[model samples]
Target: MTEFGYFLSSEEHGPQALIEQARMAEQAGFTSLWISDHFHPWTAEQGQSPFVWSVIGALSEAVSLPVQTAVTCPTRRIHPVVTAQAAATSSVMLDGRFRLGVGSGEALNESVLGDEWPEAAVRLEMLEEAVQIMRRLFRGEQVSHRGRHFTVQNARLYTLPGEPVPIDVSAFGPQAAEIAGRIGDGFITMAPVPEAIERFRRSGGGTKPVAAGLKVCWALDRDEAVQTAHRLWASEQLPGELSQILPTPRHIEQANELVTPERVAEHITCGSDADAHAAALREYVDAGFDTVYVNQIGPDQQGFFDFYRTKVLPQLNGA
Candidate 1:
């Protein structure tokens, strides 16, 4: 059965507001939670980047739903060993209901450290190395890796869960998906394309968990929802990693110039009609995702939840 989840937008909501929303999402019967792990918002308009790990800790005390980083880059901004330790600690804190979802990463967030942003192939190579490092560290073994991109000297994690933390690699392109199949316990994506899913399986992944997410604006008014969603998350409509490695918000805004509301709406469901929202999400399930996460864009978040809870989730859940 495909399960429904929600994304906690660290970019739009404050910690208290998001915690309350998470509690409400639990009450409304969401099965899982995925939060953004962005260091910077694509634009100042979206505003807010609370450290996701701290929010996860609070969520551990506030709710029972399992959580995952919609995707975190363990390659550059944070070392894989550190990420492994964090995931281990989070797993224990969440009582073994946490999964680590990682990817090649973007420069917008990583380059902030003053590291030269590498191209796609190099980024993927770094991701491969990072995954090896993370797995070794998760095993609670001493690691002294000297890779081309990263090096760690005799580092051993002191605290880890008794079991290895499950890794879900986030992949969009075919190469990345193949790598995920070769290495990851599961796969995380956004496009939810059947071909990609097939590639993942063909490469070595089986019927393990497959997760994808899409942005939405839900309201009684269609135009308002589209406008709000576009205004807030237009950057997502832009192709590639503006949030992870891009130079500036202006670069994002420039790339997003191609992301018209029409273009975004074609891929994502925006506007007020409950059935439309449900159908939009259904497309992802049809594409082979075992789990679908929905992120509400703009400020009408409570309304987004209410609409999905009362109108959308039931239909998707087979009510």
Candidate 2:
């Protein structure tokens, strides 16, 4: 059976609100949880970006569900050494239920430090080094090294759990998926396209778990949901990070003019019905993902989870 879960938006909700939702999600019968880790919201309209590590700490006490970073980048905004410490601490707090999902991040988060965004090749190189450093740290070993991307000076994780946290990679296209197969303990992705899965396995992913996420707007009123999603998150539907540095929400509003609600609506599902929600997520499972995470956009948090619990999940998971 395919595992079902929810992805909380840290950029849209505060840690307290998210903890409440996570508790509710577990009560609603979801088996796992994924949380966004972002330094910025990319647009003011999206509103909030809580420190995810702190939120996860609180969530550890609040829910029974296992949690993972939907994805974080250890290479850019935060060095691998710091990320290693954070992951080790979080793993201990979760009592060995944490999965660290990492990726080569976008400029929206990383470029804020005023460093040049390296090409994909360089980022992959940095990611490999970062993962190596994390493994060494997680072993509670003193690591002192000089690598092209990082230099760790005798760092060790003193607070790790009994087992090392599983590291999942967020892969997009072929090359990255192959790298994930070669290095990652598992794989996380948003794209449900079957070609991506085949690429991952062909490149050496083996029988490890594959997790995917899909964004939707769950509202009893479909029109209101779409409008709200477009108003707040349409910038994400655009191809790149040009709007992230534009300084204000109005700048994002202007850049969004080149794109339309129709474009955003095409990629996202918005409806008051449970069948629509199930159909949307079934695409991911049908494509062979071992686990699927549904992320709801806009507010109506209780209504969204309630609808999925009563209507969507049962149909998909055949409860």
Clash counts for the predictions, in order: 8, 1
lDDT of 1 at 60: 97
Model 1 agreement with the true structure over 27-122: per-residue lDDT tens digits: 777889999887877777878888889999999999999999978888878988788888989999998899999988777677778888898889
Q: Give the TM-score of candidate 2.
A: 0.95
The TM-score, computed over Cα atoms with residue i paired to residue i, of candidate 1 is 0.95
lDDT score at residue 174, model 2, on the 0-100 scale: 78
Q: Global lDDT for candidate 2?
A: 0.85
Assess candidate 1 and give its lDDT. Answer: 0.84
For model 2, name the residue pairs that clash: 11-48
Q: Candidate 1: minimum summed lDDT over ten consecutive residues — where?
A: 237-246
TM-scores of the candidates in the order shown: 0.95, 0.95
Q: Evaluated with TM-score, which candidate comes out highest?
A: 1
